[model samples]
Target chain A: MLPEALDAYVAAAREVGNPSSLHASGRHARRVVEEARERVAAALGCRPSEVVFTGGGTESDNLAVKGIFWARKSTSLSRTGVVVSAVEHHAVLEAADWLGKHEGAQVTTLPVNAAGKVDPARLGAVLEAYGEEIGVVSVQWANNEVGTVQPIAELAALANRYGVPFHTDAVQAAGQVPVDFAASGVAALTVTGHKLGGPIGVGALLLGRDVAATPLLHGGGHERDVRSGTVDTPGVAAFAVAVEITIKTQQEYAARVAALRDDLVKRVLSVVPDALYNGDPVDRLPGNAHFSFPGCEGDALLMLLDANGVGSSTGSACSAGIAQPSHVLLAMGADDDRARSSLRFTLGHTSTAADVDALIDALPAAVERSRRATAWKTPR
Target chain B: MSGGVDSAVAAARAHEAGHDVTGVHLALARNPQTFRTGARGCCTLEDSRDARRAADVIGIPFYVWDMADQFHDSVVDDFVAEYAAGRTPNPCLRCNEKIKFTAVLDRAVALGFDAVVTGHHARLGADGRLRRSVDNGKDQSYVLAVLTRAQLDRAVFPLGDSTKAQVREEAAVRGLAVADKPDSHDICFIADGDTKGFLAKRLGATPGDVVDARTGERVGTHEGAYAYTVGQRKGLDLRVPAADGRPRYVLSITPKTNTVTVGPREDLLVDEVTASKAIWHGAATPIECDVQLRAHGEVVPAVVTVEGGTLRARLLTPARGVAAGQAIVAYQRDAAGGDAVLGSATITAAARTSVAPEAARA
Candidate 1:
C-alpha cells in the first residue's frame, strides 16, 4: 500500500459510524461515502449515481453476471445464454458456471486468438447467430496472468449493437491503463481497491443508469437497491484517495514500470537464451513480464526463486499448490508443456530496479538447476 | 503424508518441537476417487481434505504437491510390469523408495526445506541410522530401508517412539479430524482388494493352465498367469486335491507359457532366495541376519549377502511361501538394535527345499 493510502485508511479507521443510519453521526458518514463515490466516478469517467459500491471486485463481478442474467430472465426467459471470453478470471467464469449449473443459464465461452484477445469477428458472429438468446457478454479488460490487454471498446460496441448487456472486469486495468467506463461503452465495469493501492473489502460496479440488473443482496436496499449491507465508510475513503492518486499518475507510473519491465526482460533473456516471452510483445500490461522457460516447471522455478528471496507466481496455482497450465496460454496455441512452464513477474508500485537486478542475478542458475532436478527420471 | 492420525500427530509434534514445519501431502494419483470404500485410502479426495483439515487445526501451512507423474512411472507402472514378469511386487516399498524418500524429499530440499517429515513408524537415530519403531506391530523400517544414508539424514519421523494408539490419542489432543480414521491396507491402486481384476483390466486376460508341480497333472484353468502370486492358496479353484490329500498352493507362475504351477505345501518351502536391484545402506557385507519377505510377514533367520548389487540369501531356517519379485529386507537380529533394517532387494528367484518323500505320489 502507498503511504498516502495507509495514512488515509488509518485516519478514517478511528471513526465509528454507519452510512445507512439517520443520526447526525450517520449523516457525516454518508457525506464521506458520497465524496468517495464522486471521486471514484470522476476518476473513472462515470457518474456518481452509476458507481455501486460492493464488498470487492469479485462480488462486483458476481453481481454483474448473476444479477444481470437474472434480470434478463424476467424480460425473456428464452434469453438464458451467457457469453464470456475463455480468458476471464475465475470470478466471472465461475459465476457463469454456477448460473449454468443451477440457474438454467447456457454458457458459451468464446475462444481467443494467439494474443489472448477475444476475436471481435467471432463475438460478432455469435451475436448475429444468438444475439437474442445471449443475456450478457463479458470479457476482461486485461488478463491478470499473461497481461494481454483486450480491445474492450470494439467488443463493447458490438455488444451494444446487439442490445446485450456487456460487463468488463477492469480490476487489472483500472489504475494501469486509461479506463473510461463511458468511453469503453460497457454496461457495467468492475474495479477493486487493493489492486489500486487501497484497502481491501471495498470496490465499485459502474452500472449504466439505463441498464437493468437485479440485486444480489436484499437487506437495507443500499446502493440504489442493488448491493445491500452496511457500507464500508472507512474503506471507501481509503479507496477514493487511491483511485484519485493512481489515475492522476497513471501515465507516469506506466512509463516507469514499463521501463523497468523491459529492462527485466532484456536481462533475463540475455541469461536464458531459449526462454519464450508470452502474450503480446507489443501490446501488454506495462508492469507484466511473463516468460515460459522451456525445460523448467513453473512450480520448481517459483520455489527456487522464492528461496532466493524473489517472489513470483505461476499461471494459476490453486489452494492445493497444484499448478494448472494456463488457459490463456493454451488459447494462444501454446502446447501443454509451454503452458505449464509459464511464470508471471508483476511489477507493482513497490517494485524497483534493484528487485530486477536481484532476479536476474539468480535466474540463470535457478532455471538450470530447476531443469536438471526434474530431468533425472529413470527410464521406464 | 498418508493423511492418517500418525502423520497428523507427527506433523503436530514436529511443529511443537520448534521446527519450522510445513505439512505437505503427496497427490500421488490423478483423478482421485471422490468416495473410497474403506477408511480414508491414499490419494483420495477425502484424504486430501482430511490432511488440509489437520493442517488447519495444527495452524501450519499445508500444500498438496503433485507427484502423480513420478508415482505412475515408478510405482504404479513398475507394479504392473513386475507382475507381468511373474513377480509379486510390494508397491508400498516401491512408493517408499521412489515417491516419498526420493522424489518428494528431494523436491522439499530444493524448496529450502531442511528435512522431509512423514508419519512412517520408524526411528532415525541421532547418528542418522534407521531403526525399528518402538511398536513392532507398526514397524515400517523394512519398507524404509531402501532410503540412502543421505535421505535418512534429511528425514524425520516423529511417530517413531509412539505406538499407533498413542499417535491417535495425540491426534485427538491436537484436534485433528483424522484421529479415528481407519488405517488403509492393501495396494493403494487396488482399492477393492481385487488385484487380479485390476490387472486383468490393464494387462488383459490370458487363459493359462494350472497344473500340479509334483505330478504334472492338470488341476484347473486360470484367466491370467499375472493374476496369481506364489504361495496363494485361495482363488486357485483346483478341481482335484493333492495326491497326499492335503491342500495345495500356488508355487510358481510363468508368464512366457501362461502357466501356474500348484503343489502340496512341502513344495513351497524354500531354503535359498536370490534377488536383483539390491540397494545397500552403510556397508555391503555378507552378514547373518533376519530377512522379512513381505510387509509385516515373518522375519525368518537368514544369511543375507550382497555381491555386485545382487542379493544371495541362505535361510538358516527353512521358510515357506517365498515369492519372486517380493522384497527381501534384511534386518539386524542382534540384541543391541533388535530388527534394525540393514538393506533390501527384489527377489528374482528362490531355491526350494527337496520334495518330501510322502508327497511324491503320482
Candidate 2:
C-alpha cells in the first residue's frame, strides 16, 4: 500500500467505536466511514449510496452474481438463467457453477474469441433466446489471466435491451483503465483494494440504485441491508485513499507500466523466436504480457524463472498448487498443449525498467532448459 | 518430500552439501482431499502444505508436480490389472519404476537437474552399484530393483546411510515440522489399508470358488479371486478344514478359472522360481547369490540364470509363500559388509523342484 493510504488506515485503526453504534465515538466512526465511502464513490464515478463495501473482489463478485440471481429469480420463478463469460475469474465462474448445481440455474457460458474477448453479439443471441429467464449476465471488465479488456459498455447495453441485469468484475481494470461505474451501463460493478495499491480485505460492490440484490449476510442491516457485517473501518479508509490517488494518476501509471511491459515482451520474443505471445495483442492490459513457450510445461518454466529471481506464474495455480491447463486459454481456442505451456508476467505500478531488464536477462536459459525438460521421454 | 521426516532430512542434507536443491512433492491423487481424515495416505492437501512448510524452512524453491495422470495410468492401473490376472503386484515397486524413476527423473533431467534425489533407504556405491542400506530393517532395494541402470545413474539416495530413527533425529534438529510424522505403510493410494475393498471398488465383485488343492474339491467361496494372494492363510473363510485339523494356506490363484486353491501349508513350498522382464543392474548369471522375494522378506541363497529376457532361480533352500508379480532381487554379499544389488526380475511362476528337497528327505 502507498504511504498516504497506510497513514489513513493506521489513524482509523487507533480510534475506537463501531460505525453502527449510537454513542459519540460511534457517530465519529460512522462519519469516517461515510467520508471514505464518498471518496471511493467520487473516484469510481458512482453515488455514495451505490457503493456497498464488502470483504474484497471475491466477495463483491459473489454478491453481484448470487445476490442478483436470487433476487431476480425470487421475483419471477422463470428467471433461472445465469450467463457468464468463460474467461471470468474463479470467484465468478464458481459462483455461477454453485447456482447451477443447487439453485436450478441454467448457466450459459459465453465463449470468448481467440483473443479472449466476449463478443457483444454472443450476449445478444443468448438474451434473445432466454432473456426473460436470464436473471443476470456477467463479463469481467478485464480478464485477470490474459488481461483482455472487454467492450463492457456494448455488452451492458445489449443486456439492458433484454432487461437483464449486467455485472462486471472491474477489480483488474479499475486503476489500469478508465472505470466509471455510472457510465459503464452495468447494474453492478466490482472493485477491490490491494489491486489498486490499497489494503487487502476491503472492496466495494457498486450496485445500481434500482438494482435489487438479496443480502448474502443478514445482521444489523448494513450496506443497504444487502451485505451485513461490522464495517472494516480502517480498511475502508485506506481503500478510499488508494482509490483517490490511483484514479488521479491512472493514465501516467498505465503508460509507464505499458512501456516497460512492451520492452519485456519485445526482448523476450527476440530471444525465443518460436514463443507465442498470448491474449489480445492490441487490446491487452497495459501491464500484462503472457506467452506460450512451445514444448514447455508452464510450472517447470515458472520454477526455473523463480530460481533465477524472476517471479512469474503459470496464469493460475489451483488449490493444490498444481498448475492446471489454463481454462481461459482453452476457451480462447488454444490446444491443451498450448494452454499448459503458457506463463503470465505482470508489471505492477512499482515495476521499473530494471525489473524488465532482470526478466530479459533470465528468459532464454530458463526457456531452453524448460523445453529440454519437456522433451524428455520416459523409457517405460 | 512425502510430508515425512526421512525426505525432509534428505532434502536438508542435500542442501547442506552445497548442491542447489529444489524440494518437490508429487501430487499423485486426482482429487486430493483438503485434509486427511485418517492417519494413512499421502498426496492429501495436508501433505502438500507440510511439504511447502518444509521447503520454507530449508530456504529453497519448492514445487508440487502433478503426476496424477502418469501415476494413475502406470502404477494404479497396472496394479489392478495384475491383481485381476491373479498376481500379487507391489505398487511401491511399480511406482518406483514408472513414477519416481521414469516420469519424475526424466522431467528433472530435462529441467537441468543433475539427479533426482529420494529418501529411499538404499545406497548407490561409488562404483555405481546399488547396495542395501546399512539399516537392514528399512532397506528398500527390493522395490528399487526395478529401475534400470540408466535410471539408477541419475538417482541419488541421501538417506541410505541413516536409520529411520537417525533421520527423525536429524529432522528434529533441523526443525522440520514433519520430524515426528509417522512412517507411511501399506499401499499409499489405498487410504484405508483394505486391499480387498479397494480392488472390489475398481474390479467389482466376481464370485469365485475356493478349491482344496489336495482333493481338488471346492472348500469355500470368494467374492473375487483377485482378493486372495498366494500364501495367504487368513481370511479364506473356508467352509471345511483339513482332516488332520490344520489351517490351510492359499496355494495359488487361477484367475482364468476364478478359483483360489488352498491346501496344507507344505503344499505352498517351492524350490524353483521363474521371472520375466529381467532388469540387471550390473551383475550377470548363472551366478550364485541371495534372492529377496518380498519387500522385507529374508534373502535365500540361490543360483540365478537368465535367458530370453526371463530369469530362472534355483533356491538352495525351499522357500514358501512366493508369489507371481513379486520382484526377485538378486544380491551378491560383499566381503566388506553390505550386500550389493545384482539384478531383479518379476516372478512369473513358482513350482516344486522335480526332485524332493533335502529338508523333506531328512
TM-score of each: 0.83, 0.95
Residues B81-200, candidate 1: write the lDDT tens digits: 998998898888889888888888776665557888889999887756788898899999888877877778888988877889898887877778888888887677676778788888
Error of 2 at B149 (Å): 2.5
CAPRI category for model 2? medium
Candidate No. with top TM-score: 2
Tens digits of per-residue lDDT for model 1, A277-304: 8887877889999999997888778867
Q: Best DockQ goes to which candidate?
A: 2
* Residue A318 shift from truth in candidate 2, angstroms: 2.9
TM-score of chain A of 2: 0.98
lDDT for B217 in candidate 1 is 86
How much lDDT does candidate 1 score?
Answer: 0.86
Real A-B contacts recovered, model 1: 0.21
Chain B alone: TM-score in each candidate? 0.94, 0.97
DockQ for all candidate structures vs. native: 0.26, 0.66
The residue ranges of model 2 lying beyond 4 angstroms of the native Cα positions read A376-380, B33-39, B205-209, B283-286, B306-308, B334-337, B354-362
